[model samples]
Target: MPIYIYWGEDDYAIERAVVTLRDRILDPLWTSFNYTSFPPEQSDAAIAALNQVMTPAFGAGGRLVWLMNTTLCQNCPENVLAELGRTLQVIPENSFLLLTSRNKPDERLKSTKLFKQLATEFREFPLIPPWKTELLVQAVNQAAQTVGVRLTPQSAAVLAEAVGNDTRLLYNEIEKLRLYAIEQNRPIEVDTITRLVRNTNQNSLQLAAAIRVGDTGKALTILADLINAAEPELRIVATLVGQFRTWLWVKLMVESGERNPGAIAQAAEVANPKRIYFLQQEVQSISLRQLISCLPLLLELEVSLKQGRAELSILQTKVIELCQVCRRN
Candidate 1:
């Protein structure tokens, strides 16, 4: 397996994987000669990488060529595709070619299809959306294991809730907790995580929750705290939009007399069918009309922020309006 495809929005995880691959494939003594990297700035980087990977290592270790942040899987020129087809067929067993991108490989593209056929591995490190608590918990557990630390299930959940979908933060927190555990000489518990992690109780998801129940004051407070913490305004809007959009879909499905959890989850674009039960309960008090109305206000907020309006004022006003929409009789 000499060819690898790594793609996803979780760039930190992808880079970490690349580092591990580099260590495994390149001999430390000959690393300077065996490793070649192509940043996206270089024109025809894919072709250059493919050409480089064809050459055998200069010394004892295998050759490793990395095409960083490549767009070949998204859109490849016919010439590059032709070159890729040729190189992949004869890439030496001891030489490795790695292509990484933040976007998923477009399955419809010929380049992606070719890579799928020839690449030894296709690994994705997608960022779990903040609303997916189960997946986030699993991520926390996985990172803890990799860091050689033990975490109680309750502590893992707490850590997941604190870090959300930020892979880098999750790993950093786990490492910190590992250190604390070593000092205390005990497995990580909820109290240690609570003491070590910053802003554990506040997040944009909480803002969405506050808005969902029509608690204007609480929503405004959470928004202020997030802003104070230097959270990106656009990112906050993105999370709110995704949360409301999911709620709207679930409510629409349930109102239409759809009972199957799998069907509802599919329609709502939720990864886990088990989450449908919780989503159903969330929107039970709020009307579908309310959910429908929240999206436009949220969009307006996004546009206002992007247009360079006063962030604090615009956010407060739109959040109030969203709360009002949900509060309607």
Candidate 2:
């Protein structure tokens, strides 16, 4: 429990866990001195936090050094790794080092190997697949409870389906539901969720699904809706990129004779391994090279958008080009 490594895309869960650590370790009144949060945005942030972890706590109570989004999981410089290894030896019992990241620790990286030795202290909250209604429902139900609001399983299911599996967005939606429930002085109902939740309106998955099937017309329509909804172009691009990457992984795994759906899904970072069977059947018809062609086009699309050159016309063209590969029967 002294060295906790929490890695996941679920910022909501990660933040909650971090807060729990803070409450359990740091004195409430001396929080300013005992608790420290180091996000990845600052240069040399992880190195600085690692140094602090070895320093003994000042005054009374324990010290918490939260190293959020630690890049050490990547190919960290040998000097930093050496210093971290040394610091770990002297980290006082009253001091804690909490490492977190959005992506899982890449198994290929040597840095991950060091962390692997401490596997018992590591916690991973992977991406829950959008198709896993039960998991989503459980997430929603637990979230509602956290906010002191009661939510029906049906209502929870509705929210999960509409919003997909992004816990950050789910937390925001939960706040809104709680506010609405407070105003009404009642538990959340499916009708209440249907009226207040705008998840279907905000989600861009339909666009990606349409593009996957090469339904250009539907894709274009969905894109228009997204644009009108003021969704950032980069967000839409990210969603499509993730979908294409998943398809490519599934295709490659099947070609490599990986029959275990759980293994493939885990490698692909899909939370719901049961859904991998469907992903397998879907990608079986899609050629590997055909899927590979979409990556460069998508890269170009992202670059053009970032350069302010990819307009609706350009987006339409590139989207169609990317989807064309899936059309191969």
Candidate 3:
């Protein structure tokens, strides 16, 4: 596809895909003339990217013009979309326009709609949520290849288990694993992942699990470790919200007489249906009233964090309070 569009929250994967395309299309020796990148934050650069794409390659190989890290997903002015739509028509087969953003493309935007018309050339790489182990494993494997790290199936499984659904921090762990493996002159293994990769993700999960079970002491300790690791309180709050939101959905579905975990997971947007079984068990101990109560607490924590009103200690205190409420009598 001459016109390529890639958008997703997986920033590292998005970048790697762009790099692969660049290597495949442009000549390195003539990079200055063959490739150009623009940030579409302003009108001029966005327009410039469009205008440049129609220009022919300098000497050899195809030319590439890129609109990188664009906010068009958030808001695309009418003029910009109109201009982009016009530019797409004139762009030569020899030149490629790469439109990418970390934000999911706004389906409602005119520009996004226009871009969608050329769907044959488009690629969307949305973030794979943590529960989708298979997708995470696939992405992790691809990343390992790019970063020159070797991962055995067992090692990959370990990494996938460590951060199955969320990949925001997976790249960081992969990079660290690569460095440590090179230093040790060995391949990445389950033990290597255990010893080298930070267990902050696991701890966060433990904190959420503890909160679900209403183990205040365990939850508070995990919170302390996460803070000591310099993990942001906002991030911690987001994680809790996500976990509880899933539990709440599962709980609601069960109360409504939904017996199928797959159906419940589909409704909840949980990528893995099999996980719904465990979630059902977790929420079984807590009443619907209790499950419903968790939402307001998390929302309050989020608002306080966003407003910069609460520090770590205050947030931890709130989490402890939440644990007490979640505990079954």
Q: List residue ranges in candidate 1 displaced over 4 A.
A: 183-185, 228-230, 249-281, 302-314
lDDT of 2 by residue, 1-329 (tens): 37888988777788888888788888877778878888888788877887777778877789999877887886588888887677765678899888898877888876677777653378887766554455777878887788777777688888887776767777888898777667676678888888888854545667767767778788887788777866667777777787778888999999999989889988887888888887887776668887888888889989999999856877888878766766766
Worst 10 residues of 1 by lDDT: 178-187
lDDT of each: 0.90, 0.78, 0.78
lDDT (tens digit, per residue) of candidate 1 on 144-202: 98998898999898889888888888888888877777756567888888889975347
| Count of residue pairs whose backbone atoms collide, per candidate | 0, 0, 5
Extract clashing residue pairs from model 2: none
Candidate 1: which pairs clash?
Answer: none
Per-residue error (Å), model 2, residue 58 = 3.1
TM-score per candidate: 0.88, 0.68, 0.80
Highest TM-score, which number? 1
